[model samples]
Target: MSSDRLALITTDPAVLSGQAVIAGTRVPVSVVLDCLAAGMSPEEIVAEYLTLTSEGVQAAAVRGAAGP
Candidate 1:
């Protein structure tokens, strides 16, 4: 996927206190990263979070690694 696709991760002060989250959901990017850190695959993460997408997870990983 391209960085353009990774743009799905967004932040807004009115949303989750500005934490990076998937464009259309309240799910935090950090939570996804934590799941990955804890050995959850992108597939598993998506399965667990019905609202998330594989592309969103990939984007969140990229954005999380890029740091604040």
Candidate 2:
């Protein structure tokens, strides 16, 4: 993914106890991953979580695969 796309993932101590989340939103990155793991398509995820973008979801999947 491009650096700009990766930038869509962020973390803040005041948000979800600092868990990585989509930038500017409280939706945890893991939630996106879990939805994928549970057989939900990226489009489905975005439909369910209106605040998330396709790029953000892809970035979250990449970050989740990368490990801490």
Candidate 3:
């Protein structure tokens, strides 16, 4: 993953049972990916998940596209 991707997402056992979440927020990366898949724009995702910024959502999308 790119540094921007790494910086935008974080996984910690204490947080959401270690789900890869948007950095500093409980909103999981999967949620962002799912939102995008469901046709929600980055702005829409940010509206739904207030803690997430457009950049973070974009980063998550990029990572999801890149895959494991």
What candidate 2 gets wrong by more than 4 Å, as runs, is none
Model 3 segments beyond 4 Å from truth? none
Report the C-alpha lDDT of model 3 over 1-68, residue by residue, as the tens digit. Answer: 46766678888999999988888789989999999999999999999999999888988987797784
Put down candidate 1 lDDT per residue, 1-68, tens digits, no spaces: 55776789889999999988999999999999999999999999999999999998988888877776
**lDDT of model 1, residue 21:** 92
| Preferred candidate (TM-score higher): 2 or 3 | 2
As for model 1, its CA RMSD to the true structure in angstroms is 1.2
lDDT of the candidates, in the order given = 0.90, 0.88, 0.87
Total clashes for model 2: 0
User: If scored against the real structure, what TM-score would every candidate get?
Assistant: 0.89, 0.89, 0.89
The segments of candidate 1 whose C-alpha lies over 4 angstroms from its true place after superposition are: none
User: How well does candidate 2 match the true structure in TM-score terms?
Assistant: 0.89
Q: Residue 63 deviation, candidate 3, in Å?
A: 1.7
Instruction: Tell me model 3's lDDT, rounded to 2 decimals.
Output: 0.87
Q: Deviation in angstroms for 43 in model 3?
A: 0.5
